[model samples]
Target: MARLLSELISFLEALPEPRIVMDADYRIVAANAAYMREFGAAGGLVGRRCYEVSHHFSVPCDQAGESCPLKQSLESGTPQRVLHLHHTPRGEEHVAVDTTPIRNEAGEITYFVETMSVVRHSSSRPAAQGLVGRAPAFIRMLEKVMRVAHSGAAVLLLGETGTGKELVAHAIHEASSREKGPFVPVDCAGMTETLFESELFGYEKGAFTGAAHRKLGLVEAAAGGTLFLDEIGELPLSQQVKLLRLLETGTYRRVGGLDCLSADFRLVCATHQDLRAMVAEGRFRRDLYFRINSFPIHTPALHERKEDIPLLASSLLERVDRRPGRRLSPAALNWLQGRRFDGNIRELRNLIERASLLADGDTVDLVHVQEMAEDLPLDLSASAGDAAGEFRVSGVQPLAELELAYLRWARRQQPDDTGELARALGVSPRTLYRKLRAAGA
Candidate 1:
């Protein structure tokens, strides 16, 4: 048994990615050199609980409201994969965790081997670029992005207007095998069929009245890279068949040229409209839709992941507000979070930029945000009421039902700590626990 364990440890050390071996009880029995170099800041990892080292939790990840890959692997007796936020030397980072159970000769599960892959394309904290957010919904979307990034499958980003679908598409490009290549974004909105053909398939000299010289099309320009088609739903029916033909045959020709040129580029499409309904209405081609929708991923709207407002607001402030040491006050953040952002991240950035411009001091106060946000839409159902602590409710609903809903929302806002949530709500931990249990949270 000792020799086998030694050989296993040696094998793990040979792997490049960070890996660890654990017993059935979730204790880290051994860690490879990669794991130690990456996650060994909290002293030695052997004999310590994996949850404690990764998440600082007393219990397993699932018990603390996280999807534990080890637990899932144990139950299914197979490999399990999950995206997690782990405490790293650089701070909390998004890590893709994969676990596989090891069975003995008698078919008894003896140990589990887990590998960690840090996601460099996204951040759990404020970042200068790329994706940011630690909300559950955001994590789910990011997980899908990671899963499909390495493949050559066409990706369809579905989301509402101003939800940052283009950014998400860029992230997919950056994380894919074609990261070294260019990311060409084509705005399909308001593009005419003639323009689409010439712009996408190039145009040789004298192809039309305005064509004086050979012009490279987006398809050729995006060779060995990703071609992101933004608002593909808005692409006119006449242009849909043109794109479908290009995708189906993987070949194209210049407007005035007869030679067919082979196209070599990955396709990533985004849309705010419902393509399925459009297909049924005959407004969109079923064949084109099927081709582009090979792997569909939804980019969550700001409202869908309200818990990420604070992180996103901070990140956006850093991006839009160039003034040194400029920041949003706590009250301003709370006020920003309570409002309904119908326009999603774009609206939020607009509000932040406007408030930053209005504020004289380094801190953008609640007054500044309120003054700048006067023209925005309001949610009558739940309002911030001039303060973060004040919750003004509208519409007729049972008090009990309202309480349950508010509690659920609040829990989402502070998922890690019941104690902190209770303190914020001006209630005892025990009382909050009882309420959560009764509410089936």
Candidate 2:
């Protein structure tokens, strides 16, 4: 009988859920491996009160006064079950608990055997593998992107800067039948007006000054693949005309060459700018706008989809942990959710990376995040205040006026290029020129 009891105890201990044996006084006699893993220290639990092991409290179990399963099992000398929200040193966990009284030879309750199984929170939809959120707007956008991925038509992604426009473009390309093809990205804003033509259409040897060797442009290089044109609104008007021509006939010639080459690649363009508005204002070519906007997808800004912030923060923390042991604390996550991420995902990533570097321990806390926020050269709060002040003073100025104010503020804060602001505000150089024209700046 003793051997059988020992084997039974071992079997219960090996169960996935936590198990424990306690005396009538709630003193823990034995705890299983799962309990040890969760409580962090099982050895010290023996002969300690159940409250000490589970709740880290010195008093008796709070539920014991309300017909608790453990108390009931001991009093009635019968098995009992209950669902509990258990608080431990780590965190709160939902559990299904069962307690059975062990009887002595004379039929008196000797000990209570407790078994617990964690209750997992059920999710309504299958979680997105690499993405986040299940909000209607987010789901609708994702569905649209999936639907458009099978078509061969050119896709134009529209969104604010840091809204993950490039990510959506890449998703469309990867989900399409052209998944096997290379995804080539070209930053249209990075090139100068003079360098744009040679870079996009390739240049022949000695095509222009310092053109030493024949080189293939991004268009030709992405043949049989997908060419992602990022910040396409930044393209010069002259380059827009050439790009439109290629879209119309898929034919282009190297700079200074008569031979025309045809590119058999998929085209995906992304821009934070409003091409339709630009076209209406005579800044962007109407024909070019129609050509590239065949199928359009808009990525939501971080603020617009605040519901996904928690998941995004958790994923970012996991990514941060990949480098080292750095992780986000609950306080840090709460702080992040409350923050105004003007730069959106890009800002969040930068903040996380900075916090990881500055964190003294594995867990990133609120102080670390606050320090990182303070370190940001651009005072986002002050910028927001200035914008509000301008709005109040001007009684709703034109977007151009607001943009100029924002640009001036951003330029004053950071010595780097104003390209980020230009993109985020969704204004082309020509449109910005018109803003300057109107403002007389």
In terms of TM-score, the best-performing candidate is: 1
**Which whole-number lDDT from 0 to 100 does residue 155 have in model 2?**
89
Q: TM-scores for all candidates?
A: 0.86, 0.56
lDDT of 2 by residue, 214-234 (tens): 988888888878899999988
Candidate number with greatest lDDT: 1
Candidate 1 C-alpha lDDT tens digits along 1-441: 566678889899899999999998999999999988887755778899899999989999999999999989999999999999999888999999999998876788888999998999899998767799999999999999999999999999999998889889998999998999999999999998789999999999999998989999999999999999999999989999999999999999999899999999999999999999999999999999999999999999887888898888888888998695788899888767766688899999898888889988889899988898854433334433223444456455457656775775577667789999999999999999998876666
Instruction: For model 1, give the 10-residue run with minimal summed lDDT.
Output: 378-387
Candidate 2 clashing pairs?
Answer: none
Q: What TM-score does structure 1 among the candidates reach?
A: 0.86
RMSD of each: 10.8, 17.2
- State the number of backbone clashes in model 1: 0
